[model samples]
Target: MEIFMETPTAANGGNPGKKKRSWKKLLLWLFLLILLFSLVFHFTSSLLFRKTEAGHLKFITPTVAQFRHEIAVRGDISSSENQDIKCRVRSTGGVMITWVVDEGTEVKEGDTIAVLDNSTLIDSLDAQQIKVAQSEAEVKAAENNLLTAKIAKEEYENGSYKVNLQKLVSAQIKAKEERDRLAEYLQHSKILYEKGFVTQSQLEADIFSLKQAELTLRAAELDIYVLKEYTHNKQTNNYESDIKTADANLSSKKSVHLQNETKLKDIQQQIEYCTVKSPSDGKVLYVNETNRFGSSEFLVCQGAMVRERQTFLRLPNSNKLQVTADIHEGKISYVKVGQSVQVHTDATGDKIIQGTVIKVDENPQPTNHWMGNVKEYRVTIRLENPEGVLPGMTAETKILVEESQDEKLMIPTHSVFEHGGKYYCIEKKPDGTLTPITVELGHSNDKMVIVTSGGLTEKTQLVAAAFENRELISLPELAAGETSSPTIRPKNEEISGDFNGENSNSSSPQAGMKPDGEMGSDGPKFGAGEMGQNTGMPGEIPAGMNGMRPGGPRPGGLRPGGMRPGGPRPEMDKMEQNGEMSAGMGENGFPPGMDGMTPDGPKPGMGMRPGRPRP
Candidate 1:
């Protein structure tokens, strides 16, 4: 019975083996469906959700604006030449406020702005004035003293002193003579006393007389010495005193004069400071005075005490407006004087004002580390029509530093890439493929570049910008030993032989020829017959043909004919012979020694056997 059950063929739904097989099939189908969906999603994403590595999607647009040109506009205003105002003193006691006139007030030259409190100055000046007066008086006194001293010296030398000196000298001589006489008398008295020629009393009396005489002479000599000493002391003291007095007086006078002059200058400066005037004819924009210990503008005030040299208000010249824009250092090389500029004020909408580049900064401004990694140069632009512009206005300026005109063949700068110092363009072929075409480039502004040569024409289509994350198709690989269908020929290249033949059939010779004939041999025939041929008849003269016979024709000689074996050989013969001619042969065998044939040379017709010359 178990065998017959034959595994009862496990009830279709209840058999675990059969059920497991079905479940496995279901799972496989689900996996396949999921895989298909995933593949579709990946393809769609690649096509739709494409972006550059920097998370940007790029696309190509027609470069309609091949060239950018601009014009600069600027405001007109006047500047003050007298920018600096000077005063005697700059800083003194605790930030003094010396208002001349109000900041924006108008005044003429020499007008005052403000005045310092000159109370102290005035008092000092008065004191100096008094001192000057006193010094003047002292100087006069000194002059009088000098005069008195001179008179005293002259009087002493010529009158009193001279007389006294003479008297003293005379007394000295008299005293000397008296002393000699006394000495002789004493010698004789001594002799008389020793010989006892008289009594003792008489000898003593004689000695006394000699002694008295000697004492008198000594007294006169002592008086002379005392008088001389007195006179010398007086003269020296008087001269020294006079010199001292004069020096003091002169010094005092000079000091007083200098002080007075300095005081006058101070007074004048104070008066000048009292009046205020406008430095320039500009409208005052701001007058702020909020001392908050910040920047300069914040520290200014209106009613607050404003010191000298402190900026109290700002007056911007709205008439003459200019924009100071910073250009990147990398692109500064293209900036030059006279370039056109388009300035976009932030306040204004998309409307742009025109301007011209007035100046380019020669040096770069200082940079701070906090700023992004970039270097910039300051460029000044003068607006061409600055109607409603103001100072300190922020603007974005686009400078057109270069330009090209009139339907020039231009290509994308990046499409014409360079490698190994050679420029190339990825030219599109008729088979929806690309070919690497070497190109010669010319002047380029910033984006589109000019193609000067290398078989590039206006109809030639090139890949400008490429899709991101897409592989580049190499021309050599795509060609695979097959030539590209579309051939790019430059505008100046000649048409193919097939096209030329077709053109020739459709056009007549006269129509195809230019007014001056085609270039090269197709040009107008200059000489007779074909080029490089000698086409002369039997003595038939050729017109404008040199080294040929002048007669109309000869019996059996060369002549000009409609057709000859070779073209005219004038040029060849002239070149070979180096321009030399026969000495004596003419149209009629005329001799070289003719009337008109001078020593120098013969004139053309004068030396010829006249027969209408050549044709």
Candidate 2:
């Protein structure tokens, strides 16, 4: 045509941008229709084919079986009788270990098991020796002094006292003789006067001499008396006192020497104790003990400080073996003395040693703070054949409580659940329906329990783990004194999104919405009215949404009923008051429709809700 063929752009419209926009609009409508169709199909499928809670449970058929009733416990193999080689040294601070025999080394009675650092003890011995020597010298000096004292006492008593008395007696005798001679002269003078041969003065002189002689005799007698009565007694007393003092001094010196000798002996004994020797013929076990924290101080290692009387090694009687195991309080009641046991020691490999329970503790073992209220009792087991077993080895013991001679109906312990003072088991009917039945249990071990009375047939199938689905199934009425309620929920309501149970729904007003109302027949209704109006069809902002607008306010500016830019939304407050925005609402407090949008922007699922960006 002059008709020059219209340009391809001109045939449709002058504006290519408008045509492209229309195509995009058509594509958007197509996508929305498909999404809506999928939603409807999904809802229809869910309603038609509902899942049953019992479908996930595993079922087991009850059968007659025989199983042993036993209590299994782990223990350590030890000796019934042991000679503890302990540190016998008496040191204020601990002694340092110099050398120690390797653990598990067999040795004879006289073999040295350990050696301590005796350098300090050696120094003490040397010092004690010096003290002994000093004490000995002092004792010798004391002995010499005592001898001198005794000799002085003896000389005073036997020689000096007697000699002095003899001298005094001789003087007294001489005075008496002088007195007698003077008296005779006086008598002669008187005779001469009478004969006129001498003058009167001479006679007077004789008389005076006689009187002086008499005085001298009197003095001599007094001296003799004084010597016998006073001087002799005093000398004897002094000698006796000297003897007593010497004896006392000698005794004190001897006591001091004895004390020093005792100290020297103690030091020597301590030095001997530094080298620990095996007391019997057995394997040596080093006492590497641990604390409450399970960490050891390596007490038997070289250079380690060993306390006085702390056990550093042990010599176990290999001929007599035993195991010490701890039984829990729940199972301890079933264990009794004389019960047979099978012990499997880690050291003896696969060998099973037969043993008998010898002792059962009446009281529980010391409780650990970290273990809570659990209590355990100690049990001693004497092994019958323990040839290959060694001390300090880990062993597992299985104590035979009882055995069933006849076959009985047995089920797993987990298959039974306690409801309200009664045990229950989920029984499957022939019509594919599951129902709860009361079960009377008898004896039980760790794994299986015997059903005493249940009226269940051999072909009856029961849930393997009834306790897991107890809350979901309809259970029988509570027993007479039971107060707990059965938490049976409707099938459709179980899928409703309340993380916490009924308590959370009742506590918050808004969260307790009727399931049918919140989730309509259409299945999870999502629209702009529930989210923000501006959130959908981007360009033109509509006003019916229940939250704050994404942009500032609508064109008319802020209204009295409108929420501020960053303030709380009035609709949100209403939702909170009505309990609609409670914890039952998803993880975030918003409605399910608004779950796709966040404060910052849209989440990964549906990007921008339909339209162009606003200018």
Candidate 1 local lDDT, 63-128, one digit each (tens): 433554322223222221123343333335423434344545544444444444455555655776
Residue 47, candidate 1: alpha-carbon lDDT: 49
Using lDDT as the measure, the top candidate is 2
Deviation in angstroms for 103 in model 2? 1.4
State each model's CA lDDT, in order: 0.51, 0.71
In candidate 2, what are the lDDT values of residues 374-424, reduced to their tens digit?
567899999999998889898999999988898988887777766654678
**Model 1 TM-score (2 dp):** 0.40
TM-score of each: 0.40, 0.66
**Model 2: runs farther than 4 Å from truth?**
1-63, 293-298, 412-441, 452-615
**lDDT, model 1, position 340:** 80
